[model samples]
Target chain A: MEQGIQIVSILIAGVIFYGGVGWLLDRWLGTMFWTPCGIIVGTALGVYWVVKKYGQAR
Target chain B: MGGFLIPLEGEWVSPGVHSFDSRPLFPGVLPDWVNGHLAQAVIGAALVIGFWLWVSRRQQIVPTKRQFVGEWLYDFVRNNISREALGPDYRKYHPYLLALFSFILVNNLFGEFFVFMFPTFSKIGYAYGLAVASWVLYNAAGIKRDGFGHYMKKMTLPEGVPIYMAWLIIPLEFLSNFIVRPFTLALRLFANLFAGHLVILVFVLGGTYLLTLKDNLFYNFSGGVSILFSFAIFALEIFIGALQAYIFTVLTAQYVHSSISEEH
Candidate 1:
C-alpha cells in the first residue's frame, strides 16, 4: 500500500520533471515535438526507477 | 452547478468548494489563516501530548491499563512501521514515527465527532506544512547517517548505471525523490479529507434542504433516507482517517529507510 503511493508519485515526478523541461525546450526551440518526446522518455525512466529500486528490495 | 439542492431562506446556496472555506474564529483580530482548523490542530496536538504524558507518567513492571495502552500504541508503530521499514536502525527513528502517527491520527479524527467536525489536514496548507517537515526529517536522517555528498549520490544514482545516462537519470531521481514525494504526500492527505468532508456535507446539506420542501412525501422520504445514510458515511470516514494516518506514517518510514539504507 505504501509503495503503491511512492510508485505513482515517481511516475508523476517523471512527467512533471521532464515535461517541464520539454515545455521549456519547446518554448526555446519553437517546436511542439519535444514535449511528447520528453513525456515518453520520462515515463520510461520512472518505470526503470521503480523496477530497479522497489522491485528487488521488498 | 447542481444548485437545485439547496434553497434555504428563498436563496439557493449550493454546497461546493465554498463548503471547505475557512472562516476565521475572530474575523478581524486574528489572521485568516488562524481559523477553526488551526484551533482544532492545536487542540489535537495538546490531546496527543497529554495522552502520551498521562499514559507514561509512572513506572510499571507487570503493567497498568494506561501503561499497557501506551505500550500497545508504541509497539504498533515501532514493530509494524519503523522496524518493518528501517531494520536495525529503526529505533533511531521510532520516536518521530510515533509522534507523526498519533498527531495525524488525532487531527484526522477531529473531522468525525467533535464540536468542530473538520479534519485539520483538509486544508492543503496544513498538509503541505506536515509534508515539508517529513521531507526535512528524511533528508536530514540521510545526511546524518551518511555524509551529504554520499547521500546525494546514493539517492540520485542507481547501483549500476552507464555514465552516458547521467543527464537523463539525475533529473528524474531528483524530481521523484525530492519534489514529488512530499508533494504527493500532502496532496493525498488533503484531497482525501477534503473530498470526504464534501461528501458528508452533500448528504447532510442536501438532506436537510430536501426535508423542508412543502408537502412532498417523495422528497421528504428520500431526504430522511439520505440523512440516515450519512451515519454510515461518517463510519467510513473514521476508517479512512485511521487508514490515512497509518499510510502516511508507513510511507514516511519507507522514505527514511530509502534515504539511510546502504543500497540506493
Candidate 2:
C-alpha cells in the first residue's frame, strides 16, 4: 500500500506540476498543444524517476 | 438505537459531514473553539505518555506482563520500523517514531471506542499539522547531517543525470521531495480514517432510522442486518486505524532514512 501511494503520488505530482506549467504557457501562447506535451513529458519523467529509484540493484 | 441521534423535536436527519463537526464542550461557559476533539487529543497524548512511563519504569529482566507488552511495542517500532529503515542510526529517531505511532494509533482507535467515538485525524487541519511537523523533522535531520548545500544538491539532483537536464530535474525533485512527500503522507492517513468513519456512520445511522422510523417489517430486518453488519465495519475500522498509524510512522521513518543516509 505504501509503495502504491508513493508511485501514484509521483505520477500525479508530475502531471500536476508540469500540467500547470503547460497551462500557463498555453494561456500565454494561445495554443492547446503545450498542455498535452507537458503531460506526456511529466508522465515520462515520473516513470523514469520510479525506475531510477527502484529499478537499480540495491 | 439512541434517542440523542434522532433529536428531540426536529425531523430525523441522516448522518453526513456535519457529523464530523467539532462543537464546543461547553456552549457558553468556555471558548467556542474548545471542542471535544481538543480534549480527546490531549487525553490521547497523556495516555500514550502515561502508559509508556508506567510500563517502562519497572522493567524486569525476566519480564512481567507490563514489561513484555512495553518491550514488544518498543521492539516493533525500534526494530521493524526504525532499524529496518534508518539502519544503525535508528536509535536517535526511535523515540519520535514510537511516540508518533502510539499517539496516532490511540487517536484513530477513538473512532471505534466509546466516549469519543470519533477519529481525530478526520479533521484535515490536524492531519496537516502532523504532516508539517514530520516535514520539519526530516528536513532538519537531513540538513543537519549533510549540511544545507549538500542536502539540497542531493535532494534535487540524482546522480548520473547530465548537467543540462538540471533545469527539468531540479524542479521535479524539489516538488516531489519537498512538497508532495508530506502532502501525501498526511492525506493518506486522513483520507483513510475519514472515509472509514463516514462509512460507519452511514451504516449505524441508516440502520437506526430504518429500524425505528419505518412501519414495515422488511425495513426492520434490513435495519437489523445493517446494525449487525456495522460490527464488521467496526472491525474493519479498527484494522484501518492501526494500518494508517503504521503506514504513517513507517513513511516518517522512510523520509528520515532517505534524508540521512550516506547515499542520496
Candidate 3:
C-alpha cells in the first residue's frame, strides 16, 4: 500500500510538474521549452525539502 | 511453446546495441548484434531528414503540394519559436532553428510517443546531449557577441541595482543566470522524460500484475482501469513530448537573443 501510494504521488508530481511548469515557462518566457526548466526547479524544491527534513531528523 | 492465450516472462536487458548487463533491457533480448535505442534514434532521424530531402528535391516560388506540408511545419516553428521568441532577427536564424524544431518534434512524436510501450525521449542520455548542445551554443554566442568581459558583466551584474547591494545581488545573480540555468536545462528534460516513462510503466505493469492474479474479478476491473489510464496518458504524452521539444529549442534561442541584445 505504501508503494502504491508512493507511485501515485510520483505520478501526480510528474503530471503537475511537467504540465504546470510547461505552462508557466510558456507564459513567463514566451517559450514552451522553459517548461522543462520548471520541472528542474520543482525537482530542486523537492530535493531541498527532503534534505532540510532529513537534516532536522538527524 | 504454449498457446497464444498464456503469457510468458523473460529477463530484462537494455533497449539497444548498448548492453546494460548482457541481457535484454526489457525481456527477450533482440540478439547481441542489434542496437535498439541507437538504431531507433538514428533511423528516426534518417527518416525525417530523408522525407524533407525527398519532398524538397526542387525549389519552388509557390511550393508544390509535398513541399507545402514541409513549408507549413517550417513556417509554424519559424513563426512560433524563432520570430516569436527572438523578435526581429529571427529570420536570420530560421533555417537552423526550424531544423531543430522539426528534428525534435518528429523524434519526440514518432520515435517516443508512437512506439506505444517505449518513448525514445525517455532516455536520459538523449536529453543530456540536447542540454549540452544548447548550453554550448548560447554561451558561445554570448561570448562571440560581446567579448568575454562584457558577457561576464552582463551575466553577473545587473544594471539598476544599488551599489551596496552588489555584494548580495551579484553572487545570487551569477548563480541564477550562469550556473543554474544550463544545469536545469538538461535536468528539466531528463526528469520529465524519466518520470513520464515511469508513470506509464507503473500503470501498464499494474495492469499486468492484476491480470495475473488467478482469474479474480477485481483484478480484471483494475486491469481495465489501468489500460484506459495508460491510453489516456499515451495521448497526453504526445502533447507533452512535442511541447517539451519546442520549449527547449525556443528557450535556447531566447537565451541567445538575450545574450546578443546587450540589454537586460
Candidates 1 and 3, the one with greater lDDT: 1
Worst 10 residues of 2 chain B by lDDT: B1-10
* TM-score of each model, paired residue for residue: 0.92, 0.92, 0.69
Per-residue lDDT for B1-264 in model 3, tens only?
Answer: 235424523332223323121223344545553446656667767877888798778979988899898778877888888888778887766766776666667666652344534455567676677777777777787898899999989876647656875564454445555655565666666666666666666677667666555658897788778978888877777788788787777777777676777664
Docking class of 1: medium
TM-score of chain A, all candidates:
0.92, 0.87, 0.51
In model 2 chain A, the worst 10-residue window by lDDT is A1-10
Estimate the lDDT of model 1: 0.86
The i-RMS of every model, in angstroms, reads 1.8, 2.1, 13.2
Q: Give the Å shift of residue B72 in candidate 2.
A: 1.5
User: Which tens-of-lDDT digit does each residue in B220-263 have in candidate 2?
Assistant: 89988999999999999999999999889999988898789866
Please list the C-alpha lDDT of all candidates, in the order they appear. 0.86, 0.87, 0.64
- TM-score of predicted chain B versus true chain B for each candidate: 0.94, 0.95, 0.82
Best by lDDT: 2
Higher-TM-score candidate among 2 and 3?
2
TM-score quality measure for candidate 2: 0.92
lDDT of 3: 0.64
Question: Which ranges of candidate 3 are over 4 A from the true structure?
Answer: A1-58, B1-35, B110-117
